[model samples]
Target chain A: MGLDPVKEEQNAALHKMRKRVIESIGRNMDLYGISLSTGHLYGLLFFADKPMTLDEMGSEMKMSKTSMSTGVRTLLDLKMVNKVWEKGSRKDLYEVEYDWYQTFTDFFDIKWRKSVEANILVLRKSMDEIDKIANEYAEDPEMTDMLQKDKAKLRDAYAYYEWLDRLIDTFENGDIYKLVPKEPPAKE
Target chain B: MGLDPVKEEQNAALHKMRKRVIESIGRNMDLYGISLSTGHLYGLLFFADKPMTLDEMGSEMKMSKTSMSTGVRTLLDLKMVNKVWEKGSRKDLYEVEYDWYQTFTDFFDIKWRKSVEANILVLRKSMDEIDKIANEYAEDPEMTDMLQKDKAKLRDAYAYYEWLDRLIDTFENGDIYKLVPKEPPAKE
Candidate 1:
């Protein structure tokens, strides 16, 4: 008797929009590379009453079993979602974090740290090889000038990324959240 | 005649180093969800005196022509590189920016506006849906409590994104570049 008439109509509208969004995000998966189809996977997970399995994500999207496994792994890496293993099922079940705070943490753990570290390793290796070559052509005036500019460009970007890493680490581990609670205390 | 052997040789090293850097970037494209083999594409372009063609990028990597085409399109969208039409050349020519400032400007131009707009649209859709739901469930005791929490979270995130959009918008039309140079001047 108390079901909202207005809300029921709005839900009807929302359902249509949500489906379209799911399709668009799915179509975009090709652009991101990999056979991973996140739109359908995440869409089903979001509206789910309980955590879902890799098999469920695969079957619903008509995606291959292998691709679904990898896609879920990537999603777990990104923290866009999470894995919840049921005691009786003995299989991995996934759930999306509706909370923004958790979402940001997921990004921090992967994109900012893991990816940054990997990039730096590659850069250092490349720099070492370049170092040897530069020593060989030390007498070329024009080439020397060009090389300095490129190195400085790379060095500056590296420095910037380092600064960002430290900044995010500080805040992410620090209690910045303590200062930003939404609810102010009610005055007596 | 005016060059130092040690310094000039160091510059030579940087050139080689950039190739390594570019090569590494290409190889790890999958890690970042990039569509193309960024290493192969950039590795070829890194030292090329002239721009390359779609056929060249594909043939060099031995990947499918269709995959190469899609990859190029994604790279073009990011503006990390650009397309050039050489005089007396029929096929499209492409090049990557060696200069840091030019590259950053290109990236900002192509991405800053559109990415923010897309994110804002996502937020607005979610917000509007929540509000619609909120109004309908305003009188429900438990729902009203949950709605209040959700609204505050949505509002805070929306405000932060709005501020970020404004900050990036200031960079448009070359206003910010003049006011804030690539490297700020030393304070007196």
Candidate 2:
């Protein structure tokens, strides 16, 4: 056999490590409320030294182009992956483009903010309806009191969302980013 | 007909509002990564003036007792609902037990912390595998360099999770809670 024992062992070890890292990426992505495929695609590019075309990704990941395209599109929208066109080649290549901090900030600023805004609108709409009923029973103090309590609860829920939105802004824009020492302090 | 037209219109309007509020609760719970049924059950209790028995919730929500029991159990586990045994009644009644802030903090403290811990373990396992591979390729400068870069990325990812854990701790223990006025300040 032409195989060298040491080289074979090294190849096997690297393959196993890559598999573990890719699976970890999948699990982490699920935790972040993202699809596993998107995470896996990113993991591949992250571990690779150069960009990969869609066909190569599909073959390596055992995924269809349709699924790969969808996953890649989501990563693109998240600004986690960048697409490139080779100077002399017709195929497009994709590579990891975002840092962890950028990904975290974007997820909070866009996805979390949208969810909070939607919650606020829902609370306001419900309060409006509750107000209409409370007014209809203006003469019934007990009924009005009950409605007022319900409305107040809704307002409290709305305020909580507002607080969460502000917290995200503080996390993204304030000292939390600075608190994390991105680079090691320079030697004196 | 026994129906009073004006009363019927008022009831219809109130019913629609209740439906909207319940739906909003379900939506919000989804955002918090809880089940829709749990949210719906809590929504019903939140808007009710009196505590409800399991049978009453099942009937009102058009759900079977089995589903209602499961949903109620989730809310009970989260401390969002409490069971009250009426003085003269044989049935157990359930009522809303937490303010919105309490619910949010509990979710982050318990659920979110657990998620972060799980993610940290995954990253650690991945880093270990990468370390093994890097050590295997110690003789090859190019391979070691690539592996070192990969290991650094994993460490960066690990650091991000650690930062997120600290962020949750800050939210739970820091002045954010004190900063948020639970109730509006009284007029001077």
Candidate 3:
């Protein structure tokens, strides 16, 4: 049987819409520490009707199976995609997380939380070191004063991290949706 | 006059503390689309007592004055740093915005807002295109159903961006402080 013109037109229209949005996604992916190609791959999987195998993904993306595998691995690590078993299928199948809010939370929960924790660790250690120095120079008023100032700076930084930690918790626990609802409130 | 031993010790201690924090800043700069070296330069300026000239920044960073100029320009464009007039000094001096909250807001306001706006623009265009297709296929139930589904998906994505736009406004207008206070409330 030949292709139906009407079905082909519908597919073309949908593909065009997906392409535009995917282009934007690919561009913004760098903000989240993801590569452009990987972002596009995620977008492809996102609009797909079913889980896709690496071979299928490679074919769809026009990328080598090796590259598709690596991209899928990155997405899996970020919790942006999932591997699922398909009955009678020997190959692995992966599906994208369709919930954008969940994807946002998962991405930030992993990347931002790691950066925040690392910075806080350094801040805590440096503050302790400053306290030690201040104690050593307690007899010198000038040294004590300077060290105190440095300690205060570190303390301020620590406070910011503390706030960030709470914010990260909000994302991880879905409290962010309470603040910014997933759906907009009804018009008054 | 020879350097005072006590003063030297104090400076050494302060440098050690700044170095540790700067290292973390440098590492995390990639998240904000900044180069590691530029992040370190910003960190150096953050801890400096006064605005630094290109010559001073280059010497301090062990980088060429040309590279320092380029880095300073990037920071200036990001509003993370400012150029100030120094009486009797022909050399331009720059200082970092010391308020971490302000810096955070500024960075996100510029970067995230741009991404959010661009995505929304594309979304709007794509949704409009879907609408055109739906209108053309109004008599075809199967085509209408598919187009309507795609429109709903795009609408869902648009809602997320709308929420993000509000979140960005909160940051830009300093209302975020009302939600996540700059400094935690004083212990009861």
Candidate 4:
């Protein structure tokens, strides 16, 4: 059967638009230090009408099998993509996870929280050492003044990390969406 | 005059404590993707009683002149450290700026807000592309369904970035501190 001219033209336009969307997703993820291939894979799966086999994705993205597998593994570890088993098809197909927001928050939550906790431990250790020095120099007002100042700075650093912990909690709770300005900036 | 035994012991203890603080700062900065020497330089200046010349800092930190200069320059550019002129001293001396909180917030504010803005642009671009595809596939209900779902995800991504921009603003304003639990968590 011959292809309809109008339908063929429409398909071409749709393909171009989908390619643009995938490129934009890859670019945005690059800004966050995520690899472009992983972003592109996720974007492709996100808009696909059905799950795609790794072979199909590799051919469409022009990536080698090795590269495609590596990208898929990364997305899987990040919980941004999942493997699917198609009926009567032995090959594993992949699709983008719908809870992308949760995926991102979970990744950052573990990362930033661990950092903050480590900093807190260091702050405590430093503070203990400072207290010991302060006690040894109890009679020297001059030395005490210097130690006190350092103590205050360490306290501030501690508080900063503590704030980060709370902020991350707020974000994970989904309450942060309510805090942002909803309207787009006014165009002159 | 001979060194007093008690005073000598105290001085040694204080030196050890200072070194520990510098190491902790360096480690924490490493977590944030900052160079270790730069973090150490800032940490040293933060606790110093007076501004220090490059020669003094380099000798005390046991760093090469070139390394000292590079680290100091990084801190200066970040606005976390400032150069001071000492009377009768031709060499420039450095001290940690008092507005260290602002310096840190400003650094993260620019970094994260830029990322969020870039993501917003990508989301908008992707959404526009999807809209065009939706129009072209108007007659195909299946294609339209997929396009609409992708469009919804893009909108969610946009809102996620919008939340990040606002979160950064709150941090910059220093209001985030109020949200954290002021009391230190009790040891079990």
To one decimal, what is the Cα RMSD in angstroms of model 1 from the true structure? 8.0
lDDT digits (tens) for residues A1-188 of candidate 3: 00233574546766677788888978887877789999999877866667889998888788899999999999999998999888999999999887778888888788888999999999999999988877888898877776776677778888888888877787788776676677777899
Q: By DockQ thresholds, what CAPRI class is model 3?
A: medium
The alpha-carbon lDDT assigned to residue A115 of candidate 2 equals 74
Q: Which ten residues in a row have the lowest lDDT in candidate 2 chain B?
A: B1-10
What are the lDDT figures for the candidates, one per model? 0.58, 0.73, 0.81, 0.71
Q: Number of the top candidate by lDDT?
A: 3
Model 2 lDDT tens row, B1-188: 00222543556666677678778767667655567877888888887767888898888789999988888888887778888878998988888874766766766777668867876887788788878877777788866776677678779878877877766675577545544444544659
Q: 1 or 2, which is superior by TM-score?
A: 2
**lDDT digits (tens) for residues A49-136 of candidate 1:** 4687778767766878787787777777667678887799977888877664555555655655665666677666655665565576
Pitting candidate 2 against candidate 3, the one with the higher TM-score is 3
lDDT of 4 by residue, B81-109 (tens): 88898789889988878664576676667
TM-score to true structure, per model: 0.59, 0.81, 0.89, 0.70
Best by TM-score: 3
Q: What is the lDDT of residue B99 in candidate 2?
A: 70
**How good is chain A of candidate 2, measured by TM-score?**
0.81
Worst 10 residues of 1 chain B by lDDT: B1-10
Q: What is the lDDT of residue A133 in candidate 3?
A: 78
Error of 2 at A149 (Å): 1.8
Report the Cα lDDT for residue A5, model 2: 31
Q: Which residue pairs show backbone clashes in model 4? A: none
DockQ of each: 0.18, 0.34, 0.58, 0.29
